[model samples]
Target: MSDFTTTRRSFAKGIGGTITLAALGSTASAQTAETWTTAETPTGNTLYDVERTANGVYAVGAGGIVLHRTDTGWERVLDGGPTGNGNSLYGADVTDDGERLWFVGASGAIGEMDVVSQSVDDHSAPDDVTNNFNDVAVTGVAGSANAYVAGDSGKVYYSFDDGATGTWDYTTPGSGSAVNAVDFYDARSGHIVDGNKSVFATDDGGTYDKIGLADANANFYAVDSDGADDVWIAGGGGMIHHWDGAQWTPADTGDASLRDIEVAGDDGLAVGGGGVVYGRDSDGWNRQSTPTGQNLKGVVRGGVDVAVGAGGTVIER
Candidate 1:
């Protein structure tokens, strides 16, 4: 196991509150134009993941909490989560068409939310396996996309039938090390990082081949893949690794471990411990200031940038 596995596992388990804020000034000259403001959340539960859809932005966290951001502000859409079982949701992703949102969580909890109807369909415990899921990725349209779920048991569960129970199947990509994050740039192509400090790539959705980062000392937590040539991974020791088809380059932002990252075209954002936010511009990745001191766990980058974390904390750029 990597040196940071125990620390990250504790953080993932110790996973609070709401407050609105004004634009904060940046201490770094590189991020003078970048400022983030906090949003008022309805619950104090720790949010694990956030994703943006056509309807708006949604964040999920402890006690099965799900919050939605509208034109006016944030609102609680589901209090007891997808199954009303109060499971802690850890990961979420929206479909390619932005019509549905898929979330995975503790106790094998899995759900799909319809953006237009605001209704959730529970798809938990597929194959009778009740292990906790860390993250998820969906490819294609809302109802027809393939779903890939990262498991704590070092397995990647996939469904081609929109998460239908019997359609679920899994493949082990690592040597029994927990798979932390998974992302797909296309229907059958994606990447995954695990606690063993290993990176794997799959083009056919099941079989995986070991990639680079073999000497990494930190456990990778999140990954953003744009293609076979464009991939970014965030993990312990404030490390960021990028794979451009040939080799993996590493960068250290600070001491705080990054939990999530998103890239849209040339612009990108990564969030992690101590409310640290990193912005990628034409030059390179630069740390940005945020309004909260709590650790950030998830981020979504696009027309509007938003991050959620430790508390019910929500911040936008």
Candidate 2:
């Protein structure tokens, strides 16, 4: 593990108790104050993940659908996903340069897309391991970035050579529990959360060490890492956990299960069941009224906050 010399700080100390927006009543007032609005989509398939790149925002989901947000509106860029098999895409991340988008999904499917060209390269089932990949993180340049894939088989499959079959390797991070999500801060450092309620950190890109949430009752669904010290994890029971280098602090926002979270500097957003959208600002995390009741599965913070969920729902702020 590389040495981290920066002073650690905890932002959760200022987090107040949970505030349920529904209980606030006055739909008239809430509607006017709402900042999130539903956007039209090309498909009714459920979207599992969304990502922001230099080119634009991309969303992937069931039926191998890849939707791109253009200057005009949302457009279907890839209808059959990366494999042309229509496998449901679950997670995605952009290369450090923001020119390539890598996505992983059901049936061990893995693909890389040239954001500028809209062309895809299939690198699925690396090393003949066909376990369903739940999430993926790519670091470095577009064509040769390291790819780390979270597997449902409790292992993390990785390729230092842009997911080339021969360069692929695997590591078991948790106790045979499904690895749900993975995110990288750099080429060789990142974090992964599993169904076992464990969060593991890897500094050298291979070996992993358990970091926090050892006794968490809810299953961790997603993780976003700014660095070893600054990480955000969202999971069931509306719980979001943060690692501030020295310790981990968890706060419960409400009853809805939080499926995904993204943090950039001091701002962030978390989305999950029942169209729940929680925004994190200088004050800490708080619930925000949304326009849909559909369960949200994925969210991304780019030029704007975009979230996608069940019934082909897409909302933005």
Candidate 3:
């Protein structure tokens, strides 16, 4: 195996409790008061991913916990869904219209939720291909019918039927590094980032090409795309990298390990261990104040920005 693949596997195995040690408490003194406000959660489960839905925001976490935010506030939903299995959900995505929601998690679990009908369909990896799915992405306005899930051992699965009635086809890029996240900039172009400091891009859905990175030790956790040529990746050691169509450039975020990222237009936010939140703009990345000191795991932007993490923490901006 390549050094990159081996290093990533070792890092993943030793990441437990790292987030707690990385959090230096809230840096509220350096941030403005208008930046973030704490929201209540029904459980103390560690939330792993958040996404903007048609009606509001949804966050998924440990213990089968799923929370939805509407005008009223955040409420726990999907209690009877796959979350009840207690598998830790790691990533989520929604259709452009917010009518369909897809989430992937531990033990090869994949879930699809119908927003309007309040129903869920769940699937598991084939016995021969069992691996923990870390992230999921949906492409096109056609909804969740066409989706991708990235996971351990460099596994990537594609489904053309919303994962409701058909089997998903699987592929493995060359690295064999654990894939942390995936995003599609268009119907035919997508990107996946792995723990091995590698990025893979695909334009035709059948093949993925590894994109070179300057730092081979940087562990990327999440990825987002604003357009066909603009992409952002965030991860270990406060590392943030941008892809501007031709090349990847590192954007500094101090020393924190960013776990999730969301971008809308030129605006973007990355959240990570120790409640660290960084905002991006024309001036580049800047740290933002958050109300909690808990380790943040996921962030999403919509009518409002919401972040979720350890201690069932939830905050909005």
| Every model's TM-score | 0.89, 0.89, 0.85
lDDT digits (tens) for residues 82-191 of candidate 2: 77988989888888778888888989889899988999999988888888889988778777899899999999999998887699999998799999998777768778
Cα lDDT, all candidates: 0.79, 0.80, 0.70
lDDT string, candidate 1, 1-317, tens digits: 01100111100000001112212223263546657899888888999988878788888899888899988899988877677888899999888878888899999989999977889999999998889999998887878989999999999999989998699999998798999998877677778889998878887788888775656779899988765566778899878877655566677776889999876556778889999898876666777768889999998865568899886899987
Which pairs of residues clash in candidate 2, taking residues 3 or more apart in a chain or in different chains?
none
Task: Quote the RMSD, in angstroms, for model 2.
Answer: 5.7
User: Which ten contiguous residues of candidate 3 have the minimum total lDDT?
Assistant: 1-10
Candidate 1 similarity to native, TM-score: 0.89
Q: Is candidate 1 or candidate 3 better by TM-score?
A: 1
Off by over 4 Å in 3: 1-33, 80-84, 126-128, 141-144, 164-166
Candidate 2 has an lDDT of 0.80
TM-score of model 3 (CA atoms):
0.85
User: Over the stretch 1-317, how does candidate 3's per-residue lDDT look in tens digits?
Assistant: 00000111101111111111122223333454456999877778888888776656788878666788866777888763364567778788776556777787887777777766657777666444558888887764434457788978788888766664456677886568898888775554677888788777787654787764554456888877665456677888887776655555676567889988876556677899888898765556678877788999888765567888998899998
Residue pairs in steric clash, candidate 3? Answer: 64-83, 145-162, 238-256
Give the CA lDDT, 0 to 100, for residue 233 in model 1: 82
Error of 2 at 189 (Å): 0.8
